[model samples]
Target: MRRAPTQKRSRDRVENILKAACELISASGSDTMKMGELAEKAGVSIGSLYQYFPDKASIIHALAERYNEESQHCLDEALADVTTQSGLIAAFDQLIDTYYDLFLAEPVICDIWTGTQADKTLRDMELEVSRANAQSLVRTILRLRDNDGDGATFAARCLLIMYTGEATMRLAISVPASEGREIISSYKRMMGRELSEMLQV
Candidate 1:
């Protein structure tokens, strides 16, 4: 953004702009998104929109940041009560389901996934968010399994699971709902089995 919104009204305007942009990108592909249309949908002046975001990429980046924040909050909540092995499995299931639902509910997420890949800054931001989430998962795992060896190795494994889950989810999101559910279920089973074995080792 050119300047961060300081006042409440300015912040609200920025939020509206981002919301409108998300809706537009969800309905129509991001390649065709127009600043004028975004401003009109947001019920804000074009100048006001420009005052916050200079271009469409910036708007998408802000939306991506919003998604990351929401996802992190969901992860925290899902993992909060995890202690036993069963609890960990349940937490992982909940996390996967939550993300699947989120991806299906927000079409703009598809845009964020595909659109931000080429942008190094956006990709770095996403990676940082993912790493933070992985760190949280690592802490939970270490707390539950006090004897587990090498915290860094365990954390890397956790990161791998997250990356694989995201890849599966990306593919699942494009398929039919029934097929997607099956794909996710298969993933959960595989991940659960692997985790069970890992905990035993």
Candidate 2:
């Protein structure tokens, strides 16, 4: 945002603007959404919209950040109960399935993720989210058994797992429903096998 919305009303207005942007993006995508269109949809003046978001990219950034935070919450929740090998596998599958559902529920997020490809800040933010998730995975593994002798290697594998999950989820969203389910099932089985192995010394 160009300026933070500090007051209650200001904050609400910004949220309304972002909500409007999300609707517009979901309908036609970010490439075609205009500021005037968003301002009208948000029931705010173009000037007010600009006050919070300097441009369309800023609005997408805000949306992406919001979605990323929500995803982190999902990751935290899904991994919270991970203990034994079966529990960890279940948690991992649950995390992937939950995010897959979230993406299907919120179509705008797919556009926001695609938008991240061209923007460095958004890309960096995405990497941070992955790293944080990997840390959670690493913590779970530490309580289990030594998958790799070094923490760094274990964390690196966790990061790769996160990246693979992310890719599969995105791909799953783009394919037909049946194909998507199969993709998710296959990935879950693979990850489950890997995670189950990690639990053993």
Candidate 3:
């Protein structure tokens, strides 16, 4: 945002703007979303909208941040009780289910996922979020298992899992619901096999 909304009313207006933008983008991809249209949908003046988000990219960035925050919360909750190999697999299952449901519920996620790949700023933000998640996974693994392996190496492996899972999720979300389920099921099976093998090593 160009300036953070300090007042309650200001914050509400910004929220409306973001909500309107997401609805618009969800209905008709981000490329067609204009600031004037967004302002009208948000029931705010164009100047008022500009006060919080200077441009389209800023609005998209804010939306991306929101998505990232929600995803982080889901991951944290899913990992909260993980302390064994089976628990880790179950945690991953919950995480994947949460993401799949989120994508279905929030159509804006499709745009955000694609946008991050093309925008450097968004991509960097994505990597930062991934690294944080990887660290969280690393800590969980160490707490559950006794290993003398390099911590950084384990973290890097966790990062790989996160990225691959995300990529598979993107693809899963892009297909029909039935096909998406099958895709996620296959993904979980593959991940379960890999993680089970890792536990043995």
Best by lDDT: 3
| Cα RMSD, model 1 | 1.8
- Which residue segments of model 3 deviate by more than 4 Å? 146-148
Q: Residue 74 of model 3: what lDDT?
A: 76
Give me candidate 3's TM-score against the actual structure.
0.91
Task: State which candidate, 1 or 3, has the greater lDDT.
Answer: 3
Q: RMSD in Å for candidate 3, one decimal?
A: 1.8
Best by TM-score: 2
Q: List model 1 lDDT by residue over 1-201, tens digit each.
A: 998988998888888888788788889878899999999999988898888889988888888888889888888888888878888888899889988988888788977776556889887887788788888878877777786667888778878777777678878887899999999999999989867765664
Clashing pairs in 1: none
Query: Candidate 3: deviation at residue 187, Å?
Result: 2.1
> How does candidate 1 score on lDDT?
0.83
RMSD (CA, Å), each prediction: 1.8, 1.9, 1.8
- Per-model lDDT: 0.83, 0.84, 0.85
Which ranges of candidate 2 are over 4 A from the true structure?
146-149
